[model samples]
Target: MAKNHLLLSFSFFSVLIIAQISHIFAKNTSKSPIVIQPYIIDYRNGTVTKYYNGPASFVPPPIDSQVQSKDIVIPSPSYHNLRARVFLPARPDPSRKIPVLLYFHGGAFCIGSAFGWGDSHYVAKVAAEARVIAIAVDYRLYPDFTVPAPLEDAWAALEWVAAHASRAGPGHDPWVAQYGHLGRIFAGGDSSGATIAHNLAVRVGMGHGPHLSGLFLAMPYFLGSKRVPLEPKWFPFSPNYKVWPYVCNHCKGGVNNKFINPFGRGAPSIAHLGCKKLLVYTAEVDELRGRAIWYYKRVRTSRWPGQARWIEAKGQSHIFHISKPDDPATTKLIRDLSAFVNSN
Candidate 1:
């Protein structure tokens, strides 16, 4: 029965992708068929076969000298293969408990993984620099599972991490239980993952879960009914404009859904953001930079009671540091992030 739903979703998503691609190719003068193979979905088996082909997914990097990582499952009979990848400092102070960071990887809400090469490496670097025990959540992606699904998975992971705070649990992750300082926890992500992070913090603030010390949003994926000046208006050309409505069954038919657009109609107020501090980054060339800047301003002006700040990566594109880990700005971003995590 679950497989049936999965197949249906893939079918629906495929149709949408084809429609957008068709619209894109309509304007091209060349007769060559562009082979933009992001992913292949087997409707018959309800499975997705991934390769190092597109922006959707990538092979993960191995553990480095700065931090070691391990993957562990969190039992979920409702969903298959629910898990998290934990990252910890290579050299730890045995006597001191470390801060906890719950991270989500972004792929426009459709694809990406905690185990993805860039995201995993970035998390490991953050863990090492900040001296925090980080858990990169592996949530179900779209065309298999959708908006509320990813959001629910994130909540479950947070609960699982928080559960480790008590020694009575049998499913506790050893490293998290032994070393994670739940009192100084943070949640963050990039792109769609940043959307998840924002929603999670809102949920927490509304008395839904454990408290978070800070929230980090890197190039958040937010869209609204009114189009931004820089963004193209022709909806069929950009799949992102349509992703929210398609993947999010509960979005009421548009991009204004709270999950995608935090300040949209019916969305929760920024005053209830539910964190001690917030850091938002926008790339200079990113189309969504304006929206990110708008969010930063909103948070600062809101009665959220948190210190909010914005950082713009001049001359960089969206999430550029992830792909270019060796960039000087990447090091600076990591160092600044580490300072944020470490600050009292």
Candidate 2:
């Protein structure tokens, strides 16, 4: 029991190290053992407390003057109910058939909440600025579960969103049913969530899911056993590789599994992406930027028969916009997204 306790403590310590990586890798590392407060990592006895949780729902006057939000639970007998934070514009034009977006938050699939400030704030901004109803799917995390589970949770939420457009879809929700365009539904995520977006897109292509008009991959978390130039190591088995398998339940084929390494052997081809439009953008300084570039290239050369574009933000870190929503780069991302979903 004592050894196990030590192991868990060490694991929590490692998470702390990751949270402070942004501080450490910079030119001058802090001499003091200062614990950065970006997140409250209270992992103990097999539970993690990722401190980004925000209000489950927000009203215009209280949260913001532009957007209002509420909570929706997608019931699932297979697992617990998945929580989705729905965001709508404060002032609505019912005559406008705007698009709808389904987003997943990133926590390496082990932590993070849909109601978290980063996801809620970003999605709310998109809903207001881009004239779309946004649903932030709060899927289950790891340690208690693994892949296909999170994927299932995300699909279920997407299905619910798509239902809003189907014959029996009305009454599903006021915002989506009233304003969501029939053909302009989309999905996106940050980091690990981006990886989920890609996988979900593939599932949609396989006749296994609903139609997605487009996908916005923000700093997608695709990894491989092989080393990329920018990657500090071979990734899956590198200094922090344990987190991957741990999040995946030591998934079959280890790090080379199709879920983690989409480009590896026995994996589905990018040529099978079902979406009509895909936007893959990454920050300049993100360690995973190289893989995002690789993903874009694969999609570019594939015969998927879709419009694909790539953008690289100069002098930015991984998911910088999520951490700093007011940044100019974040605004650019939202602007580009608005144009993409509203193009037609």
Candidate 3:
């Protein structure tokens, strides 16, 4: 009886040890950071925190107020709030329909807010200058929600815009009803946002509707497992390298996933692009310049029945225009973009 008692005691002690070990293991694993730490690692620890301030709500002025802005709340199942800031030109003539620009901001897909001061101001300026109604999408970011989530939000925003294209009055966006030109919609973005725009174009090509007349990818971010010629030596080891898998939930195909790298081997051809025209902008000093040029070349030679054009900003870095809006190069960019949006 004593021996049996001893055995039970040993078993009980063993259980305690195992449980303690399990607890330690869980603690260590949980402590490892799961976020995009620049120049280091990008992992998902299932925690999400906003690093930027969300734009505050404000009452928009009338159409004649140079440019009007308003916040739109889009109901989402995955997110508590998915919103967009809509910018409308002042005094749009009701007799004429205005083009719509669905814009996404760039912050590596992990940062940035559509309502951010810079983004909001930029979109407003674009709307007033290009004479197009701009909808800057505020998508869910990493750690909280991963890849495909932002894309879903973007599509939802588009759908909502389409559904409310003609619905004006109480609770509806008046700018859209008053000035939105649904038939001349365009999708545009910068950096990772540009990547999302490309994916959206692809999905639209694959039969998703509300057809886009043009696609504008400014300082686009496109990548693959293989390094391109002239790629920065540090690129292969940079935190940007890990950004794709980290935000994409460590997708099975890695960088080859069509959504992450539109130029990947298995991705659908540029021929399948839904838009009739594509405008790609690149900065001379940007690391992603090579890939943008490569994309333009491929599209130009592809079977895609669309017109493609590329413009390179001399001695400029990625998204330089956004930061230095008063620069000559930025002015040129605005001019080029305005021409594209106003073109038939």
Writing each residue's lDDT as its tens digit, candidate 2 over 75-117 gives: 6547677878888888888778878888888878876777767
Query: Which lDDT value does model 3 have at 192?
Result: 82
Could you tell me how far off, in angstroms, the CA of residue 253 lies in candidate 3 after the best superposition?
Answer: 1.2
Residue 321 alpha-carbon offset, candidate 3, angstroms: 2.1
Q: Candidates' TM-scores? A: 0.82, 0.80, 0.81
- Those runs of model 1 whose alpha carbons end farther than 4 Å from true positions after fitting are 1-61, 77-79, 228-237
Predictions in order: lDDT: 0.79, 0.78, 0.78
Q: Using TM-score as the measure, name the better of candidate 2 and candidate 3.
A: 3
Task: Sort every candidate by TM-score, greatest first.
Answer: 1, 3, 2
TM-score of predicted structure 1: 0.82
Question: What's the true lDDT of residue 11 in model 2?
Answer: 99
Clashing pairs in 2: none
Q: In angstroms, how far off is 278's CA in candidate 2?
A: 0.8
Q: Which 10 consecutive residues of model 3 have the lowest summed lDDT? A: 55-64
When summed lDDT is taken over every stretch of 10 residues in candidate 2, the lowest stretch is 31-40
What's model 3's lDDT at 145? 72
Of 1 and 2, the candidate ahead on TM-score is 1
User: After best superposition, candidate 1 residue 324: deviation in angstroms?
Assistant: 1.2
Which ten contiguous residues of candidate 1 have the minimum total lDDT?
Answer: 34-43
> What are the per-residue Cα lDDT tens digits for candidate 3 across 1-344?
99999999999999999999999999889777654454123234544444333543233422336787778776665546787888888778989989999999887777776866566666777888899999898888775678888888778766666766556533457677777778888999988888888888888898875678899999888877877776776776656666666678656688777776777767888899989999999999998888788888889999999888899999999888767766789878878889988876
